[model samples]
Target: MKYEQLANDILTHIGGRENVASLTHCITRLRFQLKDDSIVDKDKVKNIDGVVSCVNKGGQFQVVIGTHVEDVYHAVCKVGKIEADSSGEPSGEKKGLISAFFDTIAGIFVPIIGALAGAGMLKAILSLATTFNWVSPESQTYTILFMVSDIAFYYMPFFLAVSAAKKFKTNTFLALIFAGMLVHPTLIGLKDAGDAVALLGIPMRMATYTSSVIPIILIVYFQSYIERFAKKITPQAVKTFLVPIITILIVAPVGLLALGPIGAFVGEYVAAFFNLLNEKASWVVPTLVGALNPLLVMTGMHYSVGAAQAVQRATVGYATIYSPGALASNMSQAAAVFAVSIKSKKKDITALASSCAATAICGITEPALYGVTLKLKRPLYATMLAGGIAGFYAGIMGVKAYSAGTSTIFTLPIYIGQDNSFIHACITAGIAIVLGFVFSYLFHKDEEAAPVEEEVPAGKTNVELNRNQSEVYAPIKGEVVALENVKDDAFSTMAMGKGIAIEPTEGIVYAPFDGKVEVLFKTKHAIGLRSNEGVELLIHIGIDTVKLEGKHFEALVSVHDTIKQGQELIRFNISEIKQAGYDCITPIIITNTGDYLDVIESDKSNVGLDNTILTAIK
Candidate 1:
């Protein structure tokens, strides 16, 4: 795989697998929380073939991987053997409680945000459909869709339980059970009752827990402590049943009586305080939120506000301050990207700006904020200034969202029909977009990414520049398959350019086209070939087999050696490779793919040595 070497190099420079505490990825970067960030070789990582750059932000060792990060993320994780959420518990270089708190909350919520966004979209679409009467309110479609969308929110505790348990390093099953007890049907019936329900003669306070946030978090956090304590006292002979029995017996009622009410109380008071500020000084909330939004996102403290938003929605239907300012900030960021796209003359810079603009409009601002605005500096100033102005306008208009979801264009329907606020919200959003564009265009000077003097820019694995057809002979006799269907995303996504992978029947690797050997890996598992037509090619022997250090392979030629089509390049012992437990599906790739218009793989299921397996279109 093209990314195999890159992954190995990245893992090595990031202090190896042992130094990594946890690994996660956003759209453009691989966010690694390391056991020690001091050991990272940042310059070395930046210079790696596929890596874009590195940043130390929000206590994360962020290695920018561009659009093909998914491929590299999986490759790194696969080689590193990191499972989902398999981070070590918080202990290392000491961080304050505040940093740890925000980090934990963001970590738990970020993974489930996609599901949350999808549910929000469903709700928004349902509202729009019913508003216009396109779908009958009494119909099964509406009923089913409504329930599907509402289930996530109605049982927020259950979802939070699973995530919080993971963060707390406790039992997920027991956490789910704890959340279940709070929202149990029997408990709901006694919500209005003046008397407390007796659980084994202990008077337990009755509280409604559906859609509750803080209660379950508190329960799970304390559950970790209680479960450990119970296990310590219980004997190994009866530990399985008795430990859970005693832990639940203690935590269940105590949670319902003490932790449950206390957590919910905190949520209520927080909402009350915000509502209080909203009435007294309306502009303060929006202006501050808008100005600090990009900063909040950068540090992952935005999710703290997200938690508060959820709390406000559950306690009071609709949220006013957060949604309005968040929308303004997001749209303003989009407008800044649009401004940058319009001002830049370079195709690559313009293309990057255009893509970031799309994501920004969809209510995801990280791409625009990090990839474009913050990097350029002036666009960021424009965004912050324009965002505050727009936020002031939206806040004054008293715009609020009735449904609980991010303020994406898709979820705008939720803002409609709330005290005839649709027109106001729409107009306010338009102003934000226009003003953002104007301000950014004025403040930001035209700028472009650094120009490249090479045929294909360095750090780009491949580029597709032209499509003049050229035959690529088969390098090995094997079963031919489409490149897009390859198991590795790097090859399939054309991130490593384009070509096809083969399930080889033989171990010999032949020269596919007449060229000089540009470079050969020290491990003898891969080689780079540059054809006379300037088509750069890579032939990787197998997935992650480079760690073998040339054990089962032999190279027939060295770097700069003149090679002809059908000439033998390398020979491997297939049986020995398989005995070492590695898949030997070889991948042939065009590394300068971006310079070509397209690299087309053969349609045939099978091919012989030196037969045409691909056609590179210039």
Candidate 2:
């Protein structure tokens, strides 16, 4: 299937392999850890032939490639030689508050989605078995399968440790060692003893870590920093030996004695607080989550609530308000997708919107957000209003789920209880769906079709170029060179949308066309311009010239300032620049080449000033 080609294409679209710091693929997306996030051309990646979409979610830049992600992942690994799960020190600055929050929830919950799905399916099968008397609940066969199905949920901390360690860039093996200490058989035995055991002159107070969530994750994050510090300080001669010895020595005591207990205490307090809130103002919690959920989802902050769910489950064995609100919010999105599919005039948009709606109902919301709700802004508003109404009802009724899974119509049985509260919850979900459907349908407006192109009059004269009219002139007259020959791909690929490159004949650069200066980088190494004829150009002065501190160069224009053709944009002392050990090869290319049909480069071996260099055509 030419998998290598696809990988190469994807790498090119993302600004090449050098731009990537790390890469991993999950069930359906290729996640990239980029060296410079700003260099990532998301629109270019999205428009790539094989890509379904591009997303930045949960602190990871993701490219959705559907089910073939494994093939692409293999291809990427072949070229980069970096395994998807290898642990290393983090490369960039610490993530922001919201980015960190979402990363934590996504890191914790996404790994569990498969487990929850498989467990839910098994429970469904078990229900069928018991209902039809195929196997009694007491049967040995039933017991075995139940244990298999239940282990993933019952011992969730072990699974969380492995995934969280990867996310935190810590040693997974050490993290497992830490998780084992928390939930060791001996510790469980100690708990059974009721304060009977002591080790190393300190009394041991053991609590079951199985089925718990937050404590181990937080501990692992802290452990990553400690491990990284140890690695940094240890001398090269015996660093490997010294690192493990120091890391274990430092982490073991702190995790076992301090962080673990503090985390547990915090979890208990939060659980108690949530219980209090539920008892005092249950409706308020759900109402707020519901009302604000649409906004959160739009801004990609809804993962915060998922973290709250994990904490709730670890402390209280059930999540009271958040998931129910999320369920309604998701249904509202599905409704908006459906409305767009029905009302939109464009056939392609209708198909995309309908498919996105179906996908959203099944528990994935990206397609719905990227393809529908956000596309038609009014539908998003309608969904938020409807979700709030549904959340209010669910909260008043005290609806809760004992288990976590996808919040969809088919999983409604999970919310059912023998009490009237269950019935009320069901009615609330139904009304929420209906309200969303009504509001979206009423508010949605059909998009107008694009006008068809008309032919120009035969007598009309237009300036024509044989092959060079649209080609970017040498902004700085120099010997032309291919971008790939340069040291840095980021600088090399500045001409990505516009094709070709040139080694400057001289260091002084002139404005190629009469245009307004859009951006003059602070470092004086690059300039962006929009021509009066509507061409967008990026003239990067030199390879890695940003390191030169603007020496030997003087800028003549500021950003947003207008300049005429042949205007002196920047003056450079060519020999002085070369003596400073800097390459003066400059790349001049069109930044908005996508709007043109073709860009043809001139065939001339040596072109003079004002000579036709390249041409763009419709």
Candidate 3:
């Protein structure tokens, strides 16, 4: 899979592997903890062959790679190295407050989401079996499935220990040992018996660490430092065996006797605090998350809320306010996509909106936000308003979730609790979706089409200039062909942005710009360039000429060569190219056209050497 190259490219693109503070992967994405999320080039990464999409979610820059994600992940690890996980030191200054906060929460929570979801589905299946009488709840099949459902929750500390170990740059196996000691049978037995045990005469109060969240995470954090110290002091010859032995002797007693119980108590108290909020100030949590979620999502701060929910679920068996509100928020965003699809005047926008909406409903929102709603502006506002309203109602109704999964409309059924308020909560969520759709539809107006002005602007005299501007001239000369005529949509419709085509009188090509040559296709059919003025151009020598390989072409300049305007770059054997039965269609495109607007092609039927074929307006 060329993992080394993939990792190098990703590291360089993300400003370097040193800039990453943490890393993890989900079902279809690699989540990066970058020092500065703003440095990520979403569009450039999306264009990479293996990447299906790129998103900033839960405070992580996620690159979606469909089913082959593991291949890409291995490639990333190969280039960055496995030890890169422990390199938590930021390569640069800290990110902004919101980004940092979100990153922290995402770091702590995203790793567990997959385990939790898998466990939840198992539990759901077990429930269905018991409900339908397919098997008695006490039967072997039921018991096995029950264990599968319960293991993820019961051994959550072990899972967290491993993930947190990676995040803190500690020994993952050692962290597991630390986790094991906390949840060991002897400790659980002693704690259940209400015994006050002394380890090395240091008095210890024990509590159940099974299903616990924060204690092991904190323990591993301390273990990272302890392990590093152990490695340094031990002789290199004995280091392999000495490091673990010394680290365990020093860390286990201290963690079990001190740190573990303290973290457990803190988690308990936090759970109690939230329970109090639910009992007395229930509406506040939902109201706040609902009101601010959209803004949080916009700046990528919403992952903190998800982290809080994970902590809440692990401690008290339920999460308050945020999960249901997140569900509503995502559904509202989906609704905005639908609204735009139905109401947008442009045919292209309508198609884009519909496709993005479907992707959002399936649990990805970048397409909906970046591709559609954010561009429209009004839809974004409507989504926020609807989310806030839903949150307020959910808080007042005391809506809660018992499991964690992707927050989306289809997952709404998970929120249906066995309580009277559950029905009302469901109704409120539905209303939010309707309100969001209607509001966005009513407020949004399509952007006004730019007025088309003729060349030479009505009656102005056309100036014939013999002088060449520093601007890149078109390599081929003919009537400008719109990008839509191209076969690939990624290149056509200027999704990669604008350029024109030229039908050549001869199969020879001239340099379009005064710049360093960047790429010469192996097939000898396409050339990419970066002009001195920072313009990027791709001159594809002939339509579908790639089929002929280099059979009918000869290059005059190699890549990296600095060539002047009107300099011969390639000589195409015109008669031979035609004899091979290929159209001599040439596309001279501004590959970086997104950086500029109003690229004007010269009004000419034919052009000669030194003629103005194209003009780029910055």
- Judged by TM-score, which candidate is best? 2
197 in model 2: Cα distance from truth in Å? Answer: 4.8
Q: Write the per-residue lDDT of candidate 2 for residues 171-261, one digit (tens) a residue.
A: 8988888888787887787788787555566665566677777768877888899889998998889886888778778887777666777
Question: Between candidates 1 and 2, which one is better according to lDDT?
Answer: 1
Cα lDDT of all candidates, in order? 0.79, 0.71, 0.72
Q: Rank the candidates by lDDT, best first.
A: 1, 3, 2
Let me know the TM-score candidate 1 reaches against the reference structure: 0.60
Q: After superposition, how far is residue 273 of candidate 2 from its true place, in Å?
A: 2.4
The regions of model 2 sitting more than 4 angstroms off are 1-90, 124-136, 196-198, 229-242, 417-422, 449-618
Per model, how many backbone clashes are there?
A: 17, 14, 2
For model 3, how does the per-residue alpha-carbon lDDT over 282-341 read when each residue is reduced to its tens digit? 877776766567666655567667666766777877778477677667777788788989
- Selected candidate, larger TM-score, 1 vs 2: 2
TM-score of each: 0.60, 0.64, 0.62
Worst 10-residue stretch by lDDT in candidate 2? Answer: 85-94
Worst 10 residues of 3 by lDDT: 461-470
Error of 1 at 173 (Å): 1.0
Minimum summed lDDT over a 10-residue window in model 1 is located at 85-94
